[model samples]
Target: MAPKPPTAVTRPPISDSSLVYVPEDVVEGYQERIETGIDWTLIELGAQHHRRKAINREAIPTITFSDGLINKINRGYLKGFLDDTSCINLDQQWEQILPATLWDNEKFATDEGKILFNGINCLTDDLIKLIYKAVVTGNRDTLWSELKMAEVLRVNNEKITELDVGLLEFKKLVSLNLCGNYIMDIEPNFIPPTLRALELQANHISNINSFVESLPHHLIYIGLAKNLLTDESVDAFSRLPFNLTVLDLSDNDIYHLDPLLDALVRLPNLTSLYLVGNPCSVCATYARLILMVLPRLKWLDSRQVLPTDRSLEPYEAHPDDLRSSYFYFTVFRVMSAPQPPKPEKGATTAFHVELELPLLDVERRKFLLYRRYESLTEILAPPEEEEVEKAISTVLRPSTKALSTIKGIDVDEASSNASNVYDHLVTKSSRVINNFTTFESNKIQWAKVMNFQEPTVKIFCPDLFALRNTFRSVITVNLVYSIVYAKSGKTEKKSSHALKMPTEQRVVLASIKCTLRNPDWTQPSQHFHWDDSLGTDEAIHWGDRDLAVIQYTQAPVKVVKGKPEADPATSSRQLPPENLTCHFGFGIETIRAS
Candidate 1:
């Protein structure tokens, strides 16, 4: 039961100061009435005597209280207080409140040295401020409810219009529980970087922009549920670092879904997005629309049913306007075969091609007889175009003597040989053309083609598929280029002429692989190996004339001094070994049969 309210009935009427002014006889009578017992006459007489005795006494009655006074007091408390030898007395019945160690000093024993300290009270602002400091500083690590602190209960759930509660230095504090407060606005300056999990629910926080903007890198989890937020607020969250994985903004005023697509596509790291309470339309059209875009999304709180072809039982009690809408969707996968890489305007062009051989979806022990001729024709068109035409003409002609000769030759062996030839041609052509095409367009035009027939088309059971994989995707297709320089309306191929090949030839095949040695030390008659060797250095000798020799080759070549001369003056100071040089050499040597 609640304690009775403070009133005259509960407490005695005498003032503490007036207690000392009471007469000695009246005090004795009061003490006698307390000790005497079992006399109805004496009890009646005592009650009457007190009323009349008070009138006879001074105008105001006085009651005195001292160490010996106050009957029925807790004896244990009084004995403990009186037994202490360090208790000091001062003027007007007061004592000094000091530590027991101070009793050792004689000077502090004087009445002037005593201090009367005040006790703590509930109605002070100081206590409330102390509670806020203890919580914000994280010194009080226990659950707030367990503290049973009076100030917390009174102030925690109230609305806070003013934020400046002298908490400036605690900006980095984390895991703040301001969930039950009445905070309407979160100004940008108030948000701190150290915050990780902020519980700001059940509050009147309307403008979340400033709060979201001020949050720094360390902040990871944010809960702004059941607020007055709209879809426009999504842009502010999207600009945040992609590291943010969990965001709960359910049950807010978000209408359109388009704003979420751009942010969702980029957040590949995000694992969960809770939109359960946000009242998204769960109709068939909306669910299908969401599925079409977010394929990676695994969780769907908004009921998105997979479409099934089987019919269901009809509803017996359908409403007048109730109806079902069926949605048809078609997802397409399409791409064009990549055209040849566009070559630079004047760079030599080399094209790359890959041949995908026909492999059975499942392996077969032998060729399936049910397979038609058209399927084979489709597989052979890339490489065996000429072979097919030759075979077709022979089949149509059917000359008696020619038929016998064709039967004698193994058709399968011939076809296998032809396929090998095609494979070699394509591989060699691509590599050779790629080498020549490395030069500028002022040089030569080069091109490549790739062809493939079924790996099964072999004379002997060779590992055709194994060979195909090694070179299948190992090339890049580029446009064929032939460098032609025009002078006086006449165009002449330069690289072909420089290569010393026939002008009419479309391609000049040259092996690029050789070994390297000391070219300067070798005689003109000796040939050293180099991986970049293109062709032989044609020597132009002027007969019977002292000629200066200028060495030229199609490979990357350089010449340095054989050894530095002991004297600088005699040393031949040569020009740098330039790739392009116009140094005059011996004139062309012409010899006529005489």
Candidate 2:
């Protein structure tokens, strides 16, 4: 291939009446080259004046410069150069020349008046500031990605640090990528809160704790690889929001992976972790330990490095095992919405799950099953194997298919005796929290039972808070298919409860005077009402008020057997919606530091 002619880098000085024009001979030369029909594509290099097209009310082009020579030059010359050139050198000399001519003693009030200013590259920091300001305050919502400021450097020789890059005008700048730089210290208040993604990989940052604190909570991805971070500042990294997913702490001086692991476990939703070049000797084992602690982790960089080899020796033995044996851990994740009494369109509620198991290490048979629960009360101990087999033989009349599925048991009567486990436990200490007593025990043992038994039932109101004119407003909505044994006989009944209050309860004026503290209620509630005066029937304040239990007001409600009728006197003991509601925003009372 023949060598292409190099274009001369010559830029004319901008003047009020220079009549900046592209030589017509260059366009004619390109046309002649094209007509020759050579194998190589011909490209013309020249600068032409580009006028801004006026926009009409309909956003349609009302008028456009009809200079045939300029249009043809743009289409034929500039298009060819952009298409054929190996690399388009946009960092031209004109940007510097133009800015040098524009900057004067006065601070430019508006970017609009600078009709001749082309933001290509002006070495002066003052000029960049003007461009930055213009980009920020202009009608166009400019993101850092769109503002190609990196290309305008007059000289890359100067040792530029975070202090040197004074982004006073670029206040709207959110995401910044300073991956390869000699930046040492990042001032706390230098960056705007709108900034999110910060990539400062190859920097001499010894103390990133301040940087982490200064960053906004909206930060999603923070890459600080190849830095001189010591163990002393490692704990400060835990202060980052739980929503962070991608954290690259690979090539740092981080030893003793336990603190990092603990911090990782605390994150509610961190899926990807990259810690390859750190001081992790048995990195595989360490990663597995982390996985054992954090069940939700999907990708670990060490796993990608050494696949098929489990880091931990024991877990490596059981290659086929799906469950990680890291002493059971419960993770709470946000749920979609509240389970309403009735579904409403477009209504959203958030929920979180809490794992219910004691973190214990043992070779127990029940530890195999990973049961997810919102609370520990839901766990019921399983029954014994002997009793389970007996129950299976007597209660369950196994069919041919059921008999064939039983392990090691023949299709004869032995198969009928074989119990189906996983559903129920035959343990004595298996306790279910009924209304009598809430499930207070921390541990719930499962029995290797004979027959499959259903789980414990829980009853709750559809919208307990919504129900008015009642005491003990919302009742527990019980779980279905839970069978209970009665002395009369074993009966299958719907696990449901009724909310009833006492009648003929008289309110004494002394009770009101002794009980109410603030005597003012700001929020609304269906439960209690505030009496207007210190001793009058007129009620003023309502809703949930923070008050101390100074005295017992009244035992206003009594439970009646069967479906108890609603009592009018028990109006104060109701909730707004008589159903199960999922609480999302900080527990009922959200407290911030004073």
Candidate 3:
């Protein structure tokens, strides 16, 4: 009893799990059966694999999709996915499905499809399929027919060197931006007919004429800034359709304004023009000249053209005005004696007198002198400082007389003998006679006191001058006088006067003041003078002079005598003489031999 109790206490409960052993022959046979079963399964699997491969090869299309075509399909599938409401918030689903559905379809995938997709982005599958069809068939009209809904297309900065004419087939494209590209030349018909605004700025485009000619007639705005453009290219604007209203030509090599302006004139509806960074932009009076020439221009150089700018007149006088107003003067003399020595010799003498006169203003005097002696090139040349100083000096010199004169003398034998007897008297009397012919002799010779000369004095033709130290103001003056000679001791008067002398002589003079209506002598307006207080025309006394004992000569003296009524149509203001010819005269007297 004690041994049984000990055994029960020593052994833990007998284990339920244990390894078993089989006979070697039985194990070998089992191994052989296992190998046979593995071989049978392998054979069946190989047959199934071949059948699946054959099915795949037969069912799949022969067309191979290029990487680009796959990308295009991917983009189009993604766009369609986004457009479908059911695919919202299912981008991961689309990413997994698109490659398998469209891109895997080898029937549509092609190299040309890849190119079409690479040229444009953000298109729908309908458009992608249409474009793919066009590329495959080389039918651009099919592509355009599909893209009729596209209003704008931007392919700027795309590294595109040449434009694809197929892109221009988009019949509904309204705005196009191809700026910031390497595009140098654009082929004709490369722009759609529906495009109204086009931007080709910052491109290597140099054939602006061809580009302009290729533009659609309905285009209203075009930007061509930062391109290789010159004056020649700008002339293309004239041929541009009038519907174009806005143009940008900044940063081009347009040096002359005439061609550009002429081109602009052809654009009647062009109200906005940009020429900043052009050679003509830096010219003086550029805006004014442009506004004046292009009357319809409402905006220029980024600023609005004001009414005042359009109304302003040029500072320089017109050429026709200068030609009509320019004038100068000359001097001559007449002499008479008391008696004739013989019938062969005449009793009077006439000769030309030489005198030096002053210039009116330095500027006008220099202008006239330069115009007379120098070519237009010299006149327009930029003056050096030294040349300016020399001009001033020349203007100040007394030798530079504005009025020129000639001199001569005619005398009979008796007068010559009397002159020898009175040689000293002759010189003194000659000095006295010269004083009478001097500009100072005329009481109303304001030109002397004013120090004014012809052409130069005409400058004051637009100004009012008051008498020195007096409140009385005179607007104009008329220097009316002439010289004549008559035969001494002869009762009959000849119709014509000649240069000769007798035994004695005398002198006559006249001067007067009047008011003129129009001071601008350059214009063709009528001109006349009248007394200011009396409101009547003033006349000069020809015969009333200090010298006496002389017969009147046949010098055709048509003198204005009494106050005459002013012509209603004529201007009463004194103006510079219209004709350039001026006349001055002098006289002398001689007592008879007792």
Candidate 4:
């Protein structure tokens, strides 16, 4: 409701502050004239006409609510306003169905604080027996006829813990306000099928797994505000009746918007909704996601929905640019990888990543954008021609310094059979993701003062983009990288001037997993920094100059540092740091299907 001062009712005997003031119904001339004597024939005709109209309204529900009928009623209402006449006493034509109150166009005000209701009426054992007897015996004068005959009931702010079985007796009940009670669970067969609206707000009720199935199919509105609701409570909403249109869950404990929206998308008729004061409402993409997930909504909270609400510019990469856009990636450099102290393993394969990034849809997905867009192929398309892979070097870049003498550098022998040991070991799923798999090379390196410069990598997954989660503002993707290490061996010195050749033995030091948090467009590209150490408590955060130190998890890694080696004569392990952050990109230079 708008926060305007209440309007005044214009009736002389009674006044309502909530109603807009209008002139009292009055007239002179022919309007006030009345026949001195009534003709029996005319009176009988008038009574018959009135009876026929009333019968038609109830018998033809569709026609009664048709656009023409509603428009006539609205014209009468508008005429009342135009003539400066009051509606305290409505015309006989409208008195039967419409309430005698202010016009909907007139603003009304509510008191401060959460909306509440005060209901004390309830059916007792005597009333139940009387109602049953009245139904069986066709009696009308009993007490049950006077009570429970009304269409609306507000039994709020009570100690009621569950839906009352006796509530099924109200055959004409249209709305039931059971808010501000202790309803922890919902049992079947209690709610009347005729009930159209229900209020379960401000209660101890939590999960609604059974509530969805128990709900009456005719119910169109529900209020579960100010409860202990969670993501689990709304997971079963796909089973809710399709006729439901309005729902209120304001001031609740719903923090996971992904699951909640995923469930709500199945409720096709749901339009007006309220989620104020809930933890999910505070998410950065809360409004955009809600509108995207439920575009049929005509009202959200107190405001009317708008066309602009569907725009996702505030949350994700400009999806409209996908046709012209490209998915690209670059391994700029490992910020501070230590050079292997072994003089032989000069340039070991830094990171070997054999990965499969398939567009997957799983239950309880942490990322909501994936569900909205469905697949990367849908959001992004292949260009008319494929772009060539840039001459990227995942290998170390050539040194800028000049070497006076070049020795018998056997680069091909060091690379040969480098992946023999670690190729057999595979990476399994992590706790958060289930569709991931990886393998690394066996060769390893221990950097003393090795610095990684920007290196180019062939963009493998071109049909990919960052996916955003409703709860977090950043878009992220997961990747696993291995730090290959060389196996220890004694350096054999060649006789005389003939220098000895370095042995080819390799081992996988460790394979680490990382999540790339895409930087916003307004901000400069963020760089990745090598982690000082490895631990479970490590975090992924931005550092100075947009560089972030990634402390990745090693849950499914192939090997740990202290694991036993095949040769006892080999030197002690000199494992390199586990993490490094650098410039990265994933433009679509090449496209592959999963």
Distance from true position, residue 189, model 4, in Å?
1.1
TM-score, per-candidate, Cα-based = 0.25, 0.28, 0.32, 0.33
Q: What lDDT would each prediction earn against the true structure?
A: 0.31, 0.34, 0.42, 0.42
Clashes of 3: 15
Model 3 TM-score relative to the real fold: 0.32
Error of 1 at 135 (Å): 16
Per-residue lDDT of model 3, residues 1-594, tens digit only: 554432221211112201012233342343222112121223324333433443354453332112222334345443443333543333343446654655554457577776654445543325445545554654445554555556766655454556655564566788877765556667665667888998877766665776677788888999887666776676777988779888988655566666678778988889888876554543333454566677787776567766765635543212222111111221211222122222223323221222212121223223333233122113233335545544563443212012111112243433432221111111012212121112322211212111122212211110101000001112223332222223444433352342223233222221223221211111212122222233343422222221122223333334367856444224232232322222221111111111
- What does the lDDT read for residue 550 in candidate 2? 16
Give the lDDT ranking, best first.
Answer: 4, 3, 2, 1
Runs in model 1 lying further than 4 Å from the true structure: 1-156, 165-168, 264-268, 281-594
RMSD of each: 42.7, 30.8, 46.6, 28.5
How would you encode candidate 1's per-residue C-alpha lDDT over 94-161 as one tens digit per residue? Answer: 12222232353334544533321111112112443443444354333321222223221112223333
Alpha carbon deviation, residue 566, candidate 4 (Å): 90
After superposition, which runs of candidate 3 have C-alpha atoms over 4 Å from their true positions? 1-148, 314-594
TM-score of 4: 0.33
Error of 3 at 115 (Å): 27
